[model samples]
Target chain A: MLQWRNSLARHATRQSVSVLFTSVGRRVELMRAFREAYETLGLDGKIVGVDIDPLAPALQVVDHPYIVPRLNSPEFIPTLVEICRQEKITLVFPLIDPDIPILAANRTILEETGARVVVISSNAVALTADKWLTNQFFERLGLPTPRSWLPAQCDPDEIDYPVFIKPRRGSAAKSTFRVSDPEELRFFSRYVPDPIIQEYLSGPEITNDVICDLEGEVLSVVSRQRIEVRWGEVAKGVTIYNPDIIDACVQIARALPAVGPITVQCMMKDDVPHFTEINARLGGGLPLGIAAGVDSPKWLLAKAAGIAVDIPPLGSYQRDLYLTRFDESFFLTKDDRAQMASRCL
Target chain B: MLQWRNSLARHATRQSVSVLFTSVGRRVELMRAFREAYETLGLDGKIVGVDIDPLAPALQVVDHPYIVPRLNSPEFIPTLVEICRQEKITLVFPLIDPDIPILAANRTILEETGARVVVISSNAVALTADKWLTNQFFERLGLPTPRSWLPAQCDPDEIDYPVFIKPRRGSAAKSTFRVSDPEELRFFSRYVPDPIIQEYLSGPEITNDVICDLEGEVLSVVSRQRIEVRWGEVAKGVTIYNPDIIDACVQIARALPAVGPITVQCMMKDDVPHFTEINARLGGGLPLGIAAGVDSPKWLLAKAAGIAVDIPPLGSYQRDLYLTRFDESFFLTKDDRAQMASRCL
Candidate 1:
């Protein structure tokens, strides 16, 4: 661990790197990870959180927390630009899928303020947002994807039972359902709006936190098997060091014009990996990869500081590491409370 | 049900009203409720969804949907104004607690474009945002709130056990817990970042859907018993006619300079209600009140449209009504997909 941490450090032109997390939600782990990165490097920097909800769990952890506005607001782009300029933010990243395109579309606007918006590409964002397009993306790359179809394109007779239904453009596991038979599918079709039905690959699910650089080169691939899930979020998971999964993730990073962190997800059936979905930004369980020593946050800071990151061989992240998520509390007091109150007022 | 819906229609002067839901997340039912109110009133209007998420479920239901920025963004205020101006929106309401102040603070910017922000006074926003101040709010009103204290203010030996530890300024049930003894309290205190230990009230919980007109007068109060809860949100619930609870809700509405919809929570012990928290915006289970005929949406739209709304008599709602929340689907087709795609590009 000691050698890995030191060898990971490399030569680069140091820049005063300040970071921002948009729509931070309850990402307290991410907040701590970035803060630790700055503290470890002995860098003079700050972590800022931008959230519409003032009471977000992550907001209380950062140096600067602001209750901004909605993503659909007209001031959305301008507001982000202003914050970037004012905070001297070197790197701006978003945790939600929808905000990716907004920041990417406003790349020029944010860049004008001398901030790098961490996103793959506009096309990647669009493809990832639309499941049908993403299926095509996987197909073209010769990667396995379940037989997916929109409601309009589906024939009830042709569709195999136990298919999975989800919102065509959904983030998180909120609107996903598994149907067992034609009757269930028919019943669901009545109310399941804007449905995307895919063949249910009832295999072990794997989450690959794929770290990429400015040149879209894969740095380290950390894979975990989401054994138990609640409400679509991984509640219990164990990390793995699968070579095939790493190769797929590496290929995905190489294929896409990705920058910074991109999350890859797939399911392994009969020793073959079938890709399901990909997020152009960081995944919720990224702390798992960071814990296993992927160090995406520090790498990001290094990039923002114009320092060359010394990445290890792909799939070198620790194997058989385990993680479990439990509910916990975080508080904001004194100045934090004052700032929160001031925002409300 | 028909008479209740009919009784809901009251006196109000009509104005050209367009509404926006900021930080709209997955509140699809709330969006549909507003649209239903407009259609019921025979009024020409539009319901718009503004969120940082490109694929918000609520966004697909609205006539207009835009991916806005985070509230912490410096341009949050200005971006909202631009959307209001471009969409000709007249009223902007926030469903999230933290966003209330953002809109209230930017009332001037929004009003410059002839838009009326649906927020209470900034002071009220601040008071309600801080749980400690909210305790004071209940105290001032002679309402029963649990015994709450700051970690620094608490004396371990004198304090009661099986107590609750919540953030002084907590939103939702994210950072809350029940401690059985000093050992657990001490252990939790070490981790629960900002601790606000309160005398745990173990009893039946009640949610009061209180509606106030633009004039800050009590319009209606509908109470429900949270029979079953999952992950801190009410899953199965039933409505009841409780006079004391209604009286308490009325007193709360009368006490605060509230506008639009406000949600009040309490725990009932020995047939008496003790106030817990106040959300100055809409509640998750508000569909019950709407189902029982407290049409706050119509009243809000009327207020925005320059129409006067005459609410029916207090406690004039259905009783013994039950509601079971089931998982279902909401869809977005070509236009929604196209709009989401366009936002990214």
Candidate 2:
């Protein structure tokens, strides 16, 4: 830990590197991690958090808090570009799924503000945003993904029982169901929009946080076995140094040519990792990887500061590090609400 | 408030009041609220948190943390009784729904250890535990609840197209689905265990935190409009001064004779509150109510210590107070885990 500080100091004097996290909803831990990284590196930086909701908890803690229009609104991109320019944001990170595609699609316009947007390529986003496309991408890479089929491709009479069905493009485990019978599958297929069915792998699920450099080079892969999940976020998890999972995540990062941080989810079937989906942004549980010493935020800040970051080889993070989470609140008074609203573009 | 501190001090002279929170999984805020109450009331107390899972996040902050057998284990009650006697516990509160029934059933044995177990009667638990029974109870009290029927009573041909089917006894929104057609309802009725069908209320949902005295008299009712929910817990909520909701909650409290704090969930339809289900214990979002000035923890501790708590009238809490939540983690080293394990009973 001390080595990085000395290395950064030796390479350059204290520099300013402001970060902008878009759609920063309830990501207080991630924002704090970046703040700590700046402090540890002795860099002058400001963490700016922007969300559509004025009551977002993360906005309460950041150095700069702004309320932006909804992602679908036309003003969303312009507001983000303006914030990046005003804050002198050196690094831009999109925190939510729906924000990724938009940011990636407009990456050039945002980069014009002199900020290095940490988003995957539009091609990678297209492959990841839809579960059906993700399955095809995984298969094309020769990775073992769950056998999936679109609604029209599935034969109700011939399909096996107890499969999983969800929307072709969804997040936060919404509208996902474990269909035990063909009748249920047929009903849910119609009920859920653009449904995709996949074989249910009744084994432990692992979430891999893959860190890549700005050049899209895979640096480290930290595998965490999800113990308990609440609302699609990991409530309890433990870091595991499984070579299979690590290698599979590295392969996925290389295939996607992912920039910054991306999360690859999979389920273990008889000790083999079967890919599920890839989130081309920081995972909700990325804090665990940082705690295990992968330190993606520190590395990202170091790279942005033009300081060489000494990232370890893959699967080098501390294993068996357990993480349990509980809800913490930020109480907003009338004045606080008004102050946040005033920052709206 | 200073009023409570003076009143508690006048009645009791720096008394010790130890609190035991059962199944204390991810209730770090609740535990901290009780700790703050004790400090404000000038009472000496130890907060004891027990969970079946050793990695429970709340355990990391309590004054005494212990691991116990599962609620179904025959040794569960015996272990709890032993801990209460050992720690000289003054008040007991169960944090989860399943734990409520077990603790209510074993209230006599637990209270025999000179601790007042803050649980409602077994009848109340039975009425609240089963969704079907809860609907019946609400209707019997002349309260407006969503029209509901057990799977056996529902005729597929006569039922409405859009409705909800969930397990007859379930919590945390598990296995709950909105059926849009007869085929979907028929499939889900068989899919969900002991399914009950209810009219799907289309309006916004509201959760009321009702605080009652030891004698089962309602003191305060705090209603919060659920702006957003994640995993059945309120993520973004705003306190609302809905008189109809307040009166309905007070009526439900009087009918059930709630002993301590209970949560009443409902959805508004055409501006009328239609009751859903009642949880016969403190709500997960009770912290918002406390912050809004209900202060149930302080009231409970004051009552337990024989102090006259100056609780205002029903619906007295500050309205329009917003609450937003984010996950916070507790990191346990290997040594911390071993220390917690050694305290297991």
Candidate 3:
């Protein structure tokens, strides 16, 4: 039965193109979007998904899911290349921000294995990896950005209370804090690794997903006001149609020369967006944007097929639609885990 | 400014009816529903809400909010009654399940203070509180229920694997366990408080919000398939039009002699609903039922005013309208806390 299924999977991929998702942990919605766009276009496509954990829910939904070594492991890239060659993967992409920089650096190596990596330039990835550098880059481009200072640059006596202390390069808000006094600031600076103190910006946070083509031209931008966050990830978001945020996103993408989908995070203060972090990949809540009529997966698929991108002049999308998430568990026995784990090699 | 606000609050309640919400921790949506319904009815109804914590988000939204003593404290009932009389609160209700039985037992004591309590008889609350009794009662009444076994009665050698071990009287799925072996069952039985063994019913969990009049006649029952749960609470729920589940909810409400709004929990296995729980109060997901056109708050409001409820003959409601919940926040100051705390006295 296993051999028959593998033969069927190979037959299906032979008739169409294949896309790969790396470190695709619990990104079932993104995988579904690509599958849907492929089915709509009358193409039988297979998604080659990879995650370190065999229990990753995203792996369950894809055709060829592999359990590879951690991204930092020496064997990781080599194993990924072998899989790409074996699966005939045409387009390789990483959904996570941390994974983007690594993938971008190994773009040439991955391309040599017949699967071209779909990521922004390493230059843009480096700037985004560090929040402090991102603020400077955004400031130079005349974009609204949060005022930031390294921990070493702060003067205790004149420093403002109620400021944010965060890592210089962080994702998912790991080791982040809000300090109200000098004591807290001093404590968190030592507590958090590579602490970067930032001016407190209060109000609603908004995320904008900007799709740019290979030519570095913005195709469309969809912004949503993140109403709630659970465990430092967006839990509830509402699609918003704001011309100013959209314009800012387009300008930022052009300045950074980001290709494919690059999502920018901003917080609204005094009715103006202050760019906080830029992710050179799809946002966690990109499905909400897609549900609101933003066809991101379709654009990415077209690019992977080496087809020219075409985004219509009118980029209108549904607004005020709320996206709320909840947990769903998939049970796998011990034997199933063992089999999937070995399949990565 | 405090004195002026107090004077205005007294004036507002003096002109219209008042509703007291006890243990109103974070029920902002329920409070909003009442506020909107009151506004539409043109009755300047003031919500007098009380919680042990002054930082309760629900308190921040109401006109009269308080920090009361713990429910188990001797001062709780007296303090609640005094506030009801002083605030001229004509209706008193508790949202928390544990608080319901205590309030139900003190129903007449609360009524003596000219504030009618919105709760069923102590008998109904007692049956609903114990899962074992609930199943036996449902089974006796010809309603489908999961076969249950007392922990002491279960033999490890002969008991079925994949049984559920849960607290006989628990809320929010606290200390619930799904054991697939004898060792697992034995271990969980020791860990769980007041453990009761139940036959595992696999399928989708459906929650039905049933609103019955003061006479225990169910006016409407809105059932929904709980698509997902977050932290053991319904987060992503879609309205389900299951005639069997709806009919079962109505019959269960009548059998229990439950009044006002009672929510029923069931598992749909092979097209038949196995009743798991019968709560004699509105559920956490009642807003979904209301959004699906149940109008529970409206029905309860009419009962509070000693007015007869007129549920339409057809009870036709919007079907398949999805209700998604997200976290929202409320900020309060030190002074705001002090004033609301004092108002409870």
Each model's TM-score?
0.52, 0.94, 0.54
Per-residue alpha-carbon lDDT of candidate 1 for residues A252-286, written as tens digits (9 for 90 to 100) = 88787678888888988888989988888888778
For residue A322, give model 2's deviation from the true position in Å.
0.4
Candidate 3 — which pairs collide? none
Task: Give TM-score values for chain A, per-prediction.
Answer: 0.92, 0.95, 0.92
Model 2 in CAPRI terms: which quality? medium
- Judged by whole-model lDDT over C-alpha atoms, candidate 1 comes out at 0.76
| Fraction of native contacts under 8 Å reproduced by each candidate | 0.00, 0.77, 0.00
lDDT of 1 by residue, B159-217 (tens): 87888887766676765777877766765565466777878877789998888766777
Runs in model 2 with CA error above 4 Å?
A1-15, B1-14, B159-161
* Superposition error at B218 for model 3 (Å): 1.3
Q: Which stretches of candidate 3 lie over 4 Å from their true place?
A: A1-345, B1-15, B306-310, B333-343
Report the TM-score of chain B alone for all candidates.
Answer: 0.90, 0.95, 0.91
Lowest summed-lDDT stretch of 10 residues in model 1 chain B? B325-334
Order of all candidates by lDDT, from best down to worst? 2, 3, 1
Q: What is the lDDT of residue B215 in candidate 1?
A: 72
Q: What is the lDDT of residue A30 in candidate 3?
A: 79
Each model's Cα RMSD: 25.9, 3.5, 16.4
Predicted structure 3: lDDT: 0.78
DockQ-based CAPRI category assigned to the predicted complex of candidate 1? incorrect
